[model samples]
Target chain A: MKALCWHGKNDIRYDTVPDPEIEHGRDAIIKVSSCAICGSDMHLYDHFIPTMEKGDVVGHEFMGEVMEVGAENKELKVGDRIVVPFTITCGECEQCRRGNFSVCERSNRNKSLADKMFGHAGAGLFGYSHLTGGYAGGQAEYVRVPFADKTHVKVPEGLTDEQVLFLGDIFPTGWQAAAQCDIQPTDTVAIWGAGPVGQFCIRSAVLLGARQVICIDNVPERLSMAEAGGAITINFDSESVLERLQELTHGKGPEKCIDAVGLEAHATRSLDSVYDRVKQAVMLESDRAHVLREMIYVCRPAGVLSIPGVYGGLVDKIPMGALMNKGLTVRTGQTHVKRWTDDLMNRIQEGQIDPSFVITHTVGLDQGPEMYKTFREKQDGCVKVVLKP
Target chain B: MSYSGKTSSSMSQSLGTSDKLARGIGWFSVGMGLFELFAPRTLTHALGMEGKETLVRACGMRQIISGIGALSDNPTPAIWSRVGGDALDIAALTPGLRDENPQKHNVELAMTFVAVTCAADLYCAQALHKRHKYPSSMVYDYSDRSGFYRLVADMHGAASDFEVPANMRAYPPMWAEFTPEKESGLL
Candidate 1:
């Protein structure tokens, strides 16, 4: 099997590794049909989140045909097409009952497939860390899925792999942002970042019935997509976010705001970190939260703040008083892609929305590392790049 | 859940409309009107459904603010990371991290605090000379300080790591203080 492994800072490489096989009752082995580079991969490409291993396969967004299924994976079967949810969970746990599957006590990831899969300590990801449930990611030709029945969603027959590939991550993540925002029909909602997730947040906001969807980003390609979708676009470099948002809202401000941009902080054309002057140099871009602080000022007194962006566990101090004073409602989390994917798929099937609009580039699995680099550096207008292995 | 009482037949009828335009563009207006009428964001905290009152927490995201807000149009003023956020000289504080040292490094706690703060999303962590501002700091903490592990208790219900809600964030010590501002402007 071949995968883009995270060796260290700026050291991601295309390397051949072992193939995958089913190892548990709720496990399955799937041949990769399609996969996409996620924004989070930037963490490794730039070394924002450092790891000790040089061979971590770091992708959670993928979809494919299931070649085999574990004994307990009865709900799913061999030959079934699936959009693999990034996390594994026992559908029967209390957390699962409540839909918090990521922290499922039963989740397991044998990154090396060197142990039990049913319900052992599974905290590594394809290429993340030994702590995140070290399960090899779908970036490879063949990947193992833990809790297969719960993690893999059968891609409804007839849906193209390209159409459903990102449903595993970006599409669902965008939907989660929109869903978590709880936008109303009349309420104006805004999204930060024009990346794939931000684009989806805009589309999903409109699909779910936001009165107005606004997008803030420096990337022209992303802003254009938002413009086509009827979302008002603004380039933060050329304008003031608070001023423009307040003007549009008559000072009452938007009811909902979402941060699709995670820790990666970039200036007009360069990346700036507290560490130094980083322009396209790919330092730990942790300034996205700065925009969140500004969002607090523009939001209506009782507005909702939704964060679909990823954040690491270690961080600086935060403003607690301001948030509490506004009586603001905040919903931030890793998108439970599985919880709402079926609903999103239905939306796609019914033509309520077409998430594939975010797809701007596609390539074979062999080009995974290069595409990932391009996507990470924001080269080639890569809002969302797709890969087929 | 936002339109608590407006269960009008027409609303359900609109929900059933065929055209994407009718379903989205059409219902959009009704949904907005009902949203206005019922103040959906004010209700439905317990709806256990998406797009409810919790949405307001999405403060100041740039994508959401583009061309429509005050700061969206302003050039962000530069703030040194050391000034805005950085290390706290543990030597100066009363119960200095080293003095009251646990096995973990205090600065490391600050790093974890920032990580979870950013990861948690609602909160933007800056340097604090005091710890009281970070009650929810542990909301993103994996530690069992407040049993917030149950916040995102159903981890499967969560998306990827980044999109998890703050409700699931670990609650830090109610009075955790921030690192004192860097002296002489050093990070």
Candidate 2:
């Protein structure tokens, strides 16, 4: 089996690795067909994520055919094409039982039974780093899925690989982010970071019935995608994001805001000072969307603010009191991939949502490095990049 | 055949006798460390917050001296995001902490160290900085040694970048170094 790996910062290579075989009774080994470069792959490739050693396999989002399944994996079978959820949950942990499957007990491979047994960092992730668990990522030719019965979301036979790849992580994430909001009928929604995840959050919010959808980003193509998704778009570069968000919302601002952007926001890291860190943070954070906060500040005092944006461990200051005082409800977490995969597949099959609408390019797995470079730069119409193995 | 026989490793490795006992002890130590670091409110009933802080402060300096400890760790980019993003409610603070009362921050290695987001970690950082005030950049960082990567994978636009990996398997708790070039796709 061949795997794409991150040798170091800006370093990626395709290397031959071993084929995956059944290791746990609950595990499933999938023969890879397709995988994609993700925003996090950019983080890993660029080295913003920290904690990785050299030659780390650098991907977790993927879908494939089951070549084998452990006896415990009764629900799955050989030859079933499925999307691997990014998490490795046991589906029985307190978190999993509560629909917080991303933090399941069997999720991370690096963690020994001595560790929480499942998760890394906040919980575990595939091929992320040794800290979480040194589990191999899924950008290879075969993947050994832990706790497969809980994590692998089956893709319908008729659907193309491109249509459901996002379901593995992004679709569920976006939908979950939308569900986190207290989206009353006719409520308005504002989203930051018109990146792919942001784009889906925009589309999914509309699908979930927000009266108005507004998106903010500096990228033209992404803003165009938001516009296509029927969202009023804002480019924070030329105008003031705060002014525009306030003006557009008739001073009440949006009823709910989502930070689709995660940690390495769109600030000048290499070109600027350490202060660039602050700028990128705020830039990617789309402070105006904290209108989730402002919704508390400006809404009818009973409005909701939902944040699906991801954050790393041990974050610095968050205003917990204002969130409390405004009588606002703030929701955030890793998406429960298993909870929605079936429904998302059905929706895709029904043509209600083609989660793959965001994809812009498809290339062979051998082109991963260059495609990663292109996609990470958001170039060549690369909102999403999927690689066929 | 065992139920886990469906899992994908042929190595047939299982926990060793010593490994199982060590695992128990490791969990106990981890629990003790968490209690010592996080449960000062409870631990204080037995040992006291003052004692814990003193011990933490002393041990922190030793960790620094021994090259394994640090007085301050780089806040994750997420924490930096929360602090810088106007999303942070500047008003919610322990009185004059946010760039207001310089004295409350004076014994620390720069007042900004107080800016970490989570209250629990802030307390930890505060106790250490209040004592030795070492200039080491990160008190802790994300790191890992046991390597794991899935042989196959998929992702989509709706997904986030950094978080999805944890959904699959345990990862190292340490953070990876940031690559500015790779981030912007310049590389």
Candidate 3:
């Protein structure tokens, strides 16, 4: 059962495959142990999500044990342990009865190929491809999962699959991009990408209160893990992330931006990331959204941008006149990770923040193709790798 | 009272990296079908379609017979023959989206890279035809599963009236010290 497949743009092999079982009836079969390599699996290892295939497999965070189940998985059993998440909900639809389990609508059995490209079609993630329901992931020693008592959670005992393997997706996508910036107490926020979902959106915008976070990034160990999670960094290649977020928010700017860097955002000389890297190297744009047009040219006005960053296709200069002349709002999707993987697994059981301190490398599942090229070239200091299996 | 063909619970399992992404899109359809069947006038002036060499060698013999039917080995009919050779390379690049093709934006960037490789060959030929529609030696015999056991037993009381709120249960990990040999002794 080796796994980590993907094979294309920068390939990814560690192959050997096949093992996952319980093909539905509320499937189960875990056994994985641990897994990680995420930053949106480098958008399916650089082929920026064209519904990956060529030996798909890959990963989606992970956790383990349960080995087998399906008899209609009554809240799972065989060995138990768990973690799972990476979307795939079915906790009884109507958007999992309003808690919006990542827009469930019956776990995407490739929901008309992501409703013919994004027109609506969400849940069903694990391994993230086939639009979103080709399942088979958790960088394998087993996997399967599906439904299994509504996409797993369990894990109880004294935690540590690197403290609940990121409740299966960048700590519930940096705590749902800082709890959709409802953050008030005095606000501030900002974010962008200091990697590993901007170090869990700088410790979930200081555990959802904000008061000041900032972040941005050019990488010095992800702006020193967003300054050890207290934030206030920047470095967008040396200052000027909209003039150092308007001199650190003293000019009424970051009331809550986020954008955790999606769609391969990398710009050195700007001009709209060199016209989104020559319209994404020729095929005229699929998405680059220079930090969503600089979070609509610096948030604040009405604030709350959010994003959670993974983005896939078609994006060309989006500012919509500063989101309708400074009244902003935005919010994004893909992270209904069972509405915040159980209060971020009780904030990793009360210690509040330590998601394996952005793991900087762990290796094993055959060193998943060299820890996916050392976590997509953020090499050596590789902000988060994990694997294990 | 129902059963004739495709069963093993209506398929969907096959995953050896989806037969290596349908044999790496059937050897990239036999290397873009032998460079558009023997370089049809240098692959129609390198995809800008100059006098379409006999319709690019008839779309390079349907991409070398769907790149040898996606390099054989049951990848759902070679990922539906590379989704019918990506709809015949978008019907031969839709006549260079007309306007007398003076490289109509290089035939709209070669039909937007063949509509993003025909949406990655129609998402890996509908995920290898919905994973070989159930029959990888069917196991669970859910006795012809009565509508998936009445939709997970009527979504178990609406998944317990939408749970997730035991005062956001902050430190509940005690299942007999959640074992995996004490989580591999905290690794």
- Top candidate on DockQ is 3
Local accuracy of candidate 3 as per-residue lDDT tens digits, A267-357: 6768988888778778888888888888888887767687989888898978798888877777788777877777667656755555776
Q: Write the per-residue lDDT of candidate 2 for residues A1-389, one digit (tens) a residue.
A: 78887776555777777776788899888887888777766667656564688667768789999998899889898899898887677888777787677666556555563254224434466777765566678888888888788778877668888778888888888887776664544667888777777877876676666677888777777777777676788786776666777788787667677777655555322222244355434544212223233234543344555566654432333456766665655567777788878777776775666666676666666667656655666644557777777
Instruction: Calculate DockQ per candidate and list them.
Output: 0.01, 0.01, 0.03
lDDT for model 3 comes to 0.72
Residue lDDT tens for model 2, B75-167: 222222322321232232233334534444432322243343224333333432332222344221101100111110111122221222223
Model 1, range A12-75, lDDT digits (tens) per residue?
Answer: 5667888887788888888888887788877666666543377777788887888888888788
Fnat computed for model 3: 0.00
> lDDT tens string, model 1, B1-187?
0111222232211111121212222233234335434553442232222262333222212212221211111111111121122122122121323434442354455446544423322121121111112133222211121111222122222222233244433232112344556333464
| Candidate 1, residue A295: lDDT | 66
Which stretches in model 1 have alpha-carbon errors above 4 Å?
A108-126, A268-288, B1-187
Kindly report which residue stretches of model 3 are placed more than 4 angstroms away from their true locations once superposed: A1-32, A47-157, A160-164, A167-184, A188-203, A206-208, A211-253, A262-289, A300-389, B1-127, B132-187
